[model samples]
Target: MAFQCQRDCYMKEFVTTVVSCCPAELKHEVNGKKETLKGFNVKLQDTILFPEGGGQPDDHGLIADVPVIRVTRQGPEAIHFVASPLAVGQEVQVKVNWERRFDHMQQHSGQHLLTALADTMFGFKTTSWDLGRQRSVIELDTPCMKPAQLQGLEEAVNEKIRAHVPVTVQLLSIDDPAVEKVRSRGLPEDHAGPIRIIDIEGIDANMCCGTHVSNLSHLQVIKLLGIEKGKKNKTNLIFLAGNRVLKYAEKSYSTERAMVSILKTGPDEHVEAVDKLQKSVKLLQKTNLSLLRDMAVLIAKNFENNPQKGNFFSLHKKEGDNEFMNIIANEINTEETLVFLTVGEDKGPGLFLLAGPSRSVAEMGPWVLKMLKGKGAGKNGRFQGKANSLAQRAEVEVFLQQHCKHQTSEEE
Candidate 1:
């Protein structure tokens, strides 16, 4: 038997079937395919299941010692799929996982309470609802609500929960003339079957397909997590209820405690402690730069006194950092003499070399690099590149002797 609801609401009916019994083992074949079993192709008249529809997840539990893997709606009936296929004419005692079911119910009911509150207190209507794992969100017709106003709405919802108002479900034929009396935003009015309407005592009444609790008290608590702007003057709000609210509270407390311990300060001073640490880092950077300048000056003085007696002179040294190396290179390049300065870590040869003006050093730069199995190019009497080995210093000196002679003979 089917009847349409005047209000366009949906009510879930609990029905029990009585039939002759046989032992049926629930079989789960859908899990192998990693797909949610939509319908169980079984012959049984002894089970009642909540099917997957209306944004509600499937119900799972044991039916006569066989695991009911999933429940889904096929046509107009709810079918229960088990872990093992059930034989024809088998009797099974069906049980639903009350914990999961109740959690879903709380979330659904909380959504209605919040939506109704938004309509009554602020003239904001709920356009849609999405019941998700861990949290649920509702979209309102208004674009934004002040934080203080949302907090008030949360307080008002929890007050209704504390009052423990009864929730009533009513079924009405869709073709009934009274259907126009109950106003709603999202439900389609011309549907075929009876519509279910859930009423929260004096608080709210709405059209919804999801399962819900019998009273507001089952929600235990209602917390508004946050609100954000949605498309076209709409607002999305996230919320938590019952056990979810408790879990969030516990997690927040643990985070604050850890922060206090790390900062070695009370809750109020943690932010200030982080600010002080940032300032200390900035001061240390300035001190390091000043020390680098002093070290570069001392290295340049040493290079002036110990010039090599040749047209080409190259000095390789371990410097404090790359910035100090560039500073020393700039100082050496100012003089008219020919010199090459290479700086690197002490573990191996330098990766960067800078050459000053001298014909023999400029010519030997590429030839000596080629002898060391490295490649480089230069113009305007300066060259720089990587050296393959620290031992290549001897090869560099010998190459300078050979190349400087050719330059000296040309000058003569």
Candidate 2:
């Protein structure tokens, strides 16, 4: 038996009696996070909310003033998932979200028309299709389509829309001979009663169980957006239909306006403006690197002039990076001198490097890493890695000074 939703796709509201209501929970795992939806699985004598199936999402609505989160099909029954329970024998009014339902109808019917024309005109069979939140996709059996072919296909779909072709639903018995003549992908295992076929006037007839508009004119227009490479050597054609096309246009215009204001350029010059800005940024970055290298040489020279004051030198620069520290170390002669360099906030996490005597560096590198909550390795008297905390930097400098002093005393 066809559910009331299938019987009248246009119906937005209906009065019905609740057959059963039981507690249920739906869980979804997303990015390792578990989200559980607590609700009641409600079975109604008949409903206006279409259950999810046939590549179409379920309709969200209200039953007895309670919000319906989802609807699913079980055999011939449509189960409504609601946040609140309803009395079994109570007569309640069910309301469907008409705006969402109508939008889906437009896109679903548009897919049927596009699929039929592609198969007939270009011999492209639709392997599958998806009705997304903002746009829909139809994956064809072919690997790709030429630009001209795509343009022609889109034009043909809109032409049929302009022709105002009527879309009708037909039900056929499982054993009917005429059923063999129509297109189908086999009935569901739990499918019962007559098979439902969506016939697009004289264009084509295919088995489907989703809600659709009564006429192609209801589609308003179909815009083929673009194509993406699909898995299994298929070509996925992306498209927007009905109000979605208008929504896309509005969003695009708004973005253009914002860019024009920011770039101080007309819509036509946005690409050139962005390209010039990117080039300017790259040049600035290159010049900054050269200046940093020159500054590193100067810093090492100043330290060499006063090497007798302290063999251990410590410096921290917020703007200096790991490469900058390496440049300074290379310029400084460190046969007897040990230098500790850090780049980042004075008391927060950053980077640290130690370069000096081979034995001292090797022994102190792991100690520095542990004290700063970091990890690093030393080779040829240079140890550096990321530090999670620089709060103990002053204490680390004092310890290094004592070690150098102890070494000097032993040498005497």
How high is the CA lDDT of each candidate model? 0.66, 0.90
Name the 10 consecutive residues with the lowest summed lDDT in model 2. 304-313
RMSD in angstroms between candidate 2 and the native structure over all alpha carbons: 2.9
The TM-score values for the models, in the order shown, are: 0.60, 0.88
lDDT tens digits by residue: candidate 2, 1-412: 6888778999988999999999999774568899898889999999889998888998989998899988999999998888888999999999999989998898899999999999998999998899998999999999989999999999999999999999999999989888898877778899999989899999989899999999999999999999999999999999999999999999999999999999999999999999999999999999998888889888998888873746778888887788899988887777788889998888898999999989989999999999889877889999999999999998898898899889889998
Q: Could you say which candidate leads in lDDT?
A: 2
Per-residue CA lDDT of model 1 for 1-412, tens digit only, reads: 1211112113222233423222344434554554443333442453444556556676666656666666655454445655455545554556667667777778888988998888899998888778787888899998789988898999999999999899887667766665566545544333345666677888776655557778888889998999887889999999998888998899988988998989889988978998998898888877877787777776666665666544444556665455665566666643444555556644465654545555544655676677545555666655666656556665565565566566657768
lDDT of 1 at 240: 91
Model 2 clash pairs are none
